[model samples]
Target chain A: MEFTLEDISDDEISRRRDLYEPLTASVRELVDAVIRTEVDDDSVREAHRLVQAAVETLRAEQIDGSYGVRFSADLQGMPWGNAVIGLRNAIAPPVQTVRDSDGRVTADFTLGAAYEGPSDCVHGGICAMVLDHVLGDAGSADDVPCYTGTISLRFLRPTPLGSLHAEAVIVERDGRKKIVQGSLSDAQGQTVTAEGVFIVPKNWDGPMPRKARRPGEA
Target chain B: MEFTLEDISDDEISRRRDLYEPLTASVRELVDAVIRTEVDDDSVREAHRLVQAAVETLRAEQIDGSYGVRFSADLQGMPWGNAVIGLRNAIAPPVQTVRDSDGRVTADFTLGAAYEGPSDCVHGGICAMVLDHVLGDAGSADDVPCYTGTISLRFLRPTPLGSLHAEAVIVERDGRKKIVQGSLSDAQGQTVTAEGVFIVPKNWDGPMPRKARRPGEA
Candidate 1:
């Protein structure tokens, strides 16, 4: 794992979040609209055209490849391109994990129509995705990057697609390996429970040397 | 599990696939663009407005709830709301599974920037998502709906983004439970391997009765 230090100020990071997070949220809403819209064919065609037009506008200027994990010098991360919690990823439910003083991580979020599998239920794979993110987050430290080695999940019951909660804690640590346990729940209770092994590479250093460029240098 | 018999014809289903699949593909491109765009703030703002406008047009017409699994009288499934393989879901990488005569399921697809978690690697959860879908599809008969009971995944190596492959097969069965094994691989070789137990409900009957309504009646 590597972290590219972009030398961005905290304020610039905040400003970028302010600019991008809402756009991500809006795009997520657009996803729901496309799935559930019962519009006339003409309206659907029009919406598709307009969406593509916006795509063209953005594609006019872009990076060459994937957005790697970038961070400020202080270790504030801009993993906004991440699939599960990326601030700029509309596909993400964007679990906003909060770390406890004791190192437990928790998040409260919701699944919607776009995440459906069975009738009214959150897809089983989605349950695993959220669990993997929260569990991986729980195993991470500011100075180290944690990668998931293995995970086992049990679907105790069908997780409904609505308000949900997730929590993860480091159950054990063995040298460079951490054992994490996590769960995803609805109001009724925990529907999916997970346990995973997270590993910190032996060759780990810290973040990369600060790049002399500012944000948006792509 | 239930299926709404929409009385949709094969010709109509093909036509709708023609209409919506391209739209889904475009929206997916839009997602990648949003992630990698290096446009100026003014351009970003303009893109946002245009995207929201498209959202508004689609929201002008709507459905009351999520799209449940729909099928035709001949049992052609239209699980267009699925997260992993939904035809109309922009978030879905949309695994196109082919069932072999021996009942194995396989898919070859690509994961782009939007699926990244670590640098240039496909997110662990996305791998699980695609695996679950393919494994479940393998476990399912045309007459039975397979639900994931448990899944265990081992990250053999970092799964790189871009072209990839997946395969699943039923290794064993215990009455209503099907034990399935699956794998996700990069060009180099297998990167993630999975084992899952899929359950067919004890009271399984079949698809829901034909609701006398036509397609797009949502």
Candidate 2:
């Protein structure tokens, strides 16, 4: 089916983006709380029960399905429970992704002690996940809607727990494919790099706002 | 430094590949039992305890480190504990990997009920991990120790859980960088396709035979 972002209606997407934005900070705090809470076991048990009850309340409002991609009329897209981009998910490492008008995407995140894997170092797999999400999104400019085909990581240096920066840029493009690379670094700028190909499905229905005005086009 | 697969003493890395070969069939039986056992809870509980005991006994006799990489004096190499190549690891599916002298790598694995994630399909992450390991090995061929820098995958179809085949080849290479593409298929053919970049450390050692050589040989 011929698809374009304009068909969805721009205000719808923007309203949804605006709807989730405030939850960004709230979700970040929730993740930190989940990770670092040092309350006694009984308190933990009580908290778990309360959380489970809250979840059931929300579950009452949902359908039987997995989280899938969703878009807005103006093409302001959002992935509700996105492992990385979902603004309301506490399990996510709490990343704020921004893509510039020039099509470069960057994310800034501060990982805490909760993200630790190897005693003092952050888990390598988690690092790979972050890179995968950031670079995949950056490569797509959040338009192509790419999935992580493969992610490889080199631990040049141990990632210390604390604030870290992750960034991605489209290095080049192949027909229907995007070459994107990304990195994770400390406050000092010591960096570990990753590069991958982001592909739009041979068949995808996504945004296209720049075509010559179609008949009756806005 | 210069290195070759022959650098490591035979006794240091050699183990009869059969040590874990039988476990493949045994694990399959265990999985079948899990699926078919019509026993009461007490019987199931007993079975679970027995399985745990067997696992602990095996774990006690093993090494403490994550399986990194190993090569033999005959120039035959293997990273045996790798979730994909690890013969004895029940957690790893029954996959065998072989790299030809010319540097191409092929992986063959059989998925069973235990590997399923969505009712009847192989877990998406497991498929990606297997492909990552295969592509990582291909890029690291010629002894260049490239860590997975980035991998992106496209899931074309639900990889049916059963006997599967994957082949990977280096599609592009530059100084210290290799791009590889490979695919997964059942008896019929291609199901999911993957491509990734394996990157060599900037200044450590060089490619394969050379990386296998001992330090200071240069």
Candidate 3:
């Protein structure tokens, strides 16, 4: 629940890279199954009853009320649930963030039936969410954290499901603001385009951004 | 189900407006209740079930499946969803598209509990979707259809729920490619900002974009 720089050593980062990265992938699949499972109604009732028992067991083992962040020597971060950076989360898809040298940002992921809104195509709301986060990543940079001052999107085409990649970069910056550019591409690399702006607080100081807030900063 | 300059007489627009004005007010109340109600779960379920039945009854009386579009003699156009000009949609948010005299494009709306993502903030994706649509309107120019060729966004801060205003204007244009800038604002103004390249498709010749395709067209 606390941290010293000693906790984020490069060696710890290396260890999580080895251990947690694969954990994230398998857990993501488990999440997918929970949503798509075709178990009978009676079976669902039984499962929930059983899960309730496990929940009680976990409650008995608690030192804290929340799932606190956990870290190894590698500084690999794992914030589970619907967290943008989760460790062992299943509901989350194959999405992972990547940083480019110019502060551009991208996420690569596969979307499935769980994301459907139309009979086909990814749900418009889901597409917007992915774009918002990826573009937010580009605008935040590693230095000055940016919040969404304003954002806009246009659904020019139907975005099909399955593997997709999104990319964004800073098109312009004015003082505390950034104009980020990006797109979602299917595996074939046909892009579904997007662009947005990000701004920091008028002053440099505020509650720290997500990466800075580390209850997991062991 | 079709309307043209010749088929629409002044009396029809006036008559239709009289019928819909109060439904608009009632729908607003329903949305407000969805947000503020603190009824017990059983009551909530009962109310929702009753509302669904009432809506189904009302839906059956309507002869047509689509809402229509119209322009008053004053050229005050109400696209009414099916229009290239869109207004309140139950499936979509109550996004009201407004065009100013200077050709700037904007939308004014309030987002509530249904849009929440973070504990207290609006969902990042919803912010991005509104911004993208607002920016697209600028590129569309109220005439030439623009598609979401690409959009980029940057989130500077968490957008709190309740009232939000977003605007977009053309930044530049070259042939079929147009660049527009946009932002989302609160009472304090300007929460998330964005820009996009909304395009005039190179190969298509149509009144609206490929999607929103009219029932008979395909």
Candidate 4:
């Protein structure tokens, strides 16, 4: 379900991006409050009333369509609605990534109490989500579109809810298919490790070859 | 992490449950709008301001702690803040499940555009999350606590965004260890299949066994 970048001007992209980030931040605060608040029933009910009214007011003015994925020519291949990278997604952590010349991608972020699964630890599913996104993105960094075909993860230990790091690297390649290995770690040490198989769709015309290496030569 | 049901009365649980459901619904609606709204930049900014003000107002009337997991005595094992089942989590779909007398579990739910990953299909990580949760829950239905130790998943095809179904069954059990197999499908057919090893923590005192089973026993 790939979408081509729209022809929106850079100015519009900046405008929309600026407008959405603050809104997302505010909503994120609300999410934290919703999960952590210990107000009494009376206060909770009062807050709910005010929140509902605010939502209704906003709904009354909305246009009748979803904010479809948008990408500018300058920022090609970036989907503003991406669940992992999209700033507009409140569930997405403030993940930042750096890709080294060796084709490894490393990310740093924090998982708050909102993502808790086992008591004070991060949710196992969220760990899978982060690894899947980082590994898939790493595979596609070769300028070839690749989709995840299979992923297996081992949870070595419960990932704590705080600063975390993840790294993904392509371990092998076979024509349009790639195998990637990744790991997520916390302050204590490695918490989860993953391996995934990614494949480029048959119809995709990938970028012209930079080096004509054989399938097993890379 | 696990939490024992507090000694709260049924009336308090019912009171709090009734209050939270509508609030969650309102916030869910707001999430949909925040992702889809198409108003002009000025309007978007105005909405942001109002939303922020409302959040601040609620925040000012703060409670000291988080809304910890709570369950009534009648619903002893239920976790209200569960990532898969929590009504207060906007990111969670409305997943409903039924456990039969034989201990098999089946679930039905819809994945909206919010969960999209590759193109228009549901996110691969989201698929893993749902399977982990459903399978883990299925393994725990025998009045024994089980946690997901490892999960392996194969994506047969892209899972489209719409109604989906999942089922899980315990294939084998040995002492406190269990092997569970699960599948997720859409209208077209099976899209993903999974196998997981669930472990009851070492200190757990599981229910008195009807029969002692070996690793290969059904």
Candidate 5:
């Protein structure tokens, strides 16, 4: 009883979000070929019987529940199935953000070997889930939707494994709380640094629908 | 170049971990039927052209490499491809732990809607990635592996979704650091509480291979 993105229709949510972003980028390239496949166990049992006959032809055409969150008046609050920025979530790296007219919320992404950890870095809980989701969207960059409550991280090094960057800023608020500040960089710079509070949910009375705010917010 | 579980062989890692846990639970039920299929936009463009012809028949039966970490001399330092408790990670919930000879470690799982957030709860960065993987496996429960350098969560409520529970212990230690206290419960109790520090890696000289400890430690 909870699905929203205002329950479908803005050209059928942009034609099913352009048909599930190339099928979640071909299941994120079959999750980086099942995390770096090296073949043979008879070619992984013939690619596991051809991915089990494409999972039984998509489970013989079915659907009863759960693909919840869908919102779109064209990508606002970006819920294409958000696990962390769902572009149809192939376990999201679906992070693509930009919010600036001085509000500042930036993010760029890349992390493979399915978000690794330690011997090739990048997984300190996926850099605290991308700095707790870009510091809860930079504490709602003032359009007010917030929610994290608390977050604190400080990895400082070891975030490697391909192009990454994140930024967030808000610094303080209170009375329904805010306090943001975030980071996560690679290619040598900051690795992880976050601080969050976020709140705004005494049953959300107003403020969130500047077309849902999150795609170059203002 | 860095794929451990001591380079495979406990009966071929228990027959490829019992053949990829029923093929990652049938691709996690075809990822909950590609997120609740309500078919028809011509059966979702014929189930997205039969999932792009099953992703071009497993990209034409090829294999280059990436299923990296795999360790099984009986799960020592358990890295079956961990995202957070990897059982071949269909986005991990391979969480099944027990460690308590007074070292304490505990965990139980459940949070599907593929780990949602803000609306059926569960997903404050997956309760800070299951309290940073159970407070970095309870600061190495004494066998010393530790890693996460900082963690701090609070949340205090809103975790609901289904059967959770987590725990961690080791309330203090220093010298190679430790701290660790964790939580995340359901059925209306403690919905997130953490404190961590962890460390132990200034080039990991010795300590971790006590069969990768942390499952009722000794």
Candidate 6:
């Protein structure tokens, strides 16, 4: 749980998002293509070469290690390297979430074929993954960064892979520990429910801003 | 819960693995590059264009929708579209697991920058994702395909990025339900422990082959 202070402006962050978000989207598209492509061997081979070339181009000038959690002086977070909701991580469904004035968090997103587990249903682990992020995000505040301490999930039914909805809210809080409750639903109704304990560590100066959790999006 | 009979031979499956495995690896590399690249804006733009070009080339010949679970007549499975262990899914840590004679399942893999959740540690949900796959894989036999019914994880500590090990075994089993326990550990020791209920549904003719689980790989 390390937070690096990045002395960059909001404008710079926005500029970087402009530069990288589309690229992330492009890579995500490539992932889907790679999975479902019925192309002949030569075409697949050529695509691989081009993908390798892209990797080389990006790797030509890069940081030594990871893009860890970075924040501006104002506490605006750039958790763009996150796996579940990272703005720059193509692997993410790029789960965009919103926080209500009442402290509830909600998101409406889609899971494609890439997220499948059984038949046309979403992977149970993926459901847990999204629920973990949503619940953990819901339990955190402006000056406190919450980390998952424990999480339990019950699959009431198989979550279908398509337009899905999720919501989370802090149901109980004991000092630094928050017990959050959440659910994942498809067009029919709720399929999976989750509860988690999110803890804000002691002596922690790291504050992961909730800028991504705008109100209107919900 | 649907499995399509691929009608492909073992040789063809091996050939397909040969074709897509490296491509998947390349895409994984691309994901890491996208995360840590500190290249200038123009270079990033160029990289984006090249990635889009590759996507277009692959899209030129593709399937209609998502790649559902496919298997050959002899029950060799190609769950290459899986998000946790899919050989073709770039989002996956591509966790490769093996089952021992005693029915224990284990894996050793490295998670890179692309799998980060907090700072340097693996995301909680990603941990759940991998464990769900591993535990479910452990409880399942060749004739019976188990699906996750419930999974609970206790984050004993933050799972650090890089080399890690995980193992799972069926602790108990009933007619259609299996109780499996698992853990994820880093160099320091155990960071996360998990327990799950995996259920084999009724009238399930779809047996997800355990071909991916060979004995020696454990």
In terms of DockQ, which candidate is strongest?
A: 6
DockQ of 2: 0.04
In angstroms, the error of model 5 at B2 is 26
After TM-score superposition, what is the CA distance of residue A184 in candidate 5 from its true location, in Å? 22
Better of 1 and 5 by TM-score: 1
- What value does the lDDT take at residue A211 in candidate 2? 25
lDDT, candidate 3, A1-218, per-residue tens:
13223356766566644543443343233222223333444443343343333223223332322233444344444443223333422223535777766776777787664454333356554677777767776776656766666555656567776778888888898888788777877866644566666777676776554455332221
Summed over model 5, clashes come to 11
The ten-residue window of minimal lDDT in model 5 chain A covers A69-78
CA RMSD (A), model 3: 12.6
Q: Between candidates 1 and 5, name the one with more favorable lDDT.
A: 1
Considering only chain B, report the TM-score of each candidate against the true chain B: 0.90, 0.76, 0.73, 0.85, 0.38, 0.91
Give the per-residue lDDT digits (tens) of candidate 4, residues B1-218: 54545677757766767877776666666666666666666666776776676566556655444334554455433344555566565555646666766878888888765676656678788888888877876787676767788889999998888889998889999877899999999988899999999999898865623221110110
Model 1 per-residue lDDT tens digits across residues B1-218:
65677777889889888877777788888889899998888888888998899899888988877877788667677888888878888888877787777877889998999998888988888988888777777776333556789999999998998999999888998888889999998888999999999888877776633332111111
Model 1 steric clash pairs: none
Q: Model 3 chain A: which ten-residue window has the lowest total lDDT?
A: A57-66
lDDT of 3 at B83: 13
Candidate 1 residue lDDT tens string, A1-218: 65567887979988888888777888998888888887778888888898888899999999888887787777666788989888888888877787776878889998898898887888888988889888887877333467899999999999988899999989898888889999999998999999999998877767533331111121
As for candidate 2, its interface RMSD to one decimal place is 14.7
Task: List pairs with backbone clashes in candidate 4.
Answer: A1-B119, A36-B66, A67-B36, A118-B1, A119-B1
- Please tell me which predicted candidate would have the highest lDDT against the true structure: 6
Report the lDDT of model 5 for residue B107.
Answer: 82
Fnat of every candidate, listed in order: 0.74, 0.03, 0.13, 0.41, 0.34, 0.79
Off by over 4 Å in 6: A142-144, A204-218, B204-218
User: Would you estimate the TM-scores of all the predictions?
Assistant: 0.92, 0.49, 0.49, 0.88, 0.37, 0.93
* Candidate DockQ scores, in order: 0.74, 0.04, 0.08, 0.45, 0.14, 0.79
Preferred candidate (lDDT higher): 1 or 3: 1
Model number with the top TM-score: 6
- What order do you get sorting by TM-score, best first? 6, 1, 4, 3, 2, 5
- How many Å off is the CA of B25 in candidate 3? 4.2
lDDT tens digits by residue: candidate 5, B90-209:
666556667778877888878676566555666688788778877777777788676777889988877876789899898888798889888888877898898988788778777655
Question: What clash pairs does model 6 have?
Answer: A118-B1, A119-B1
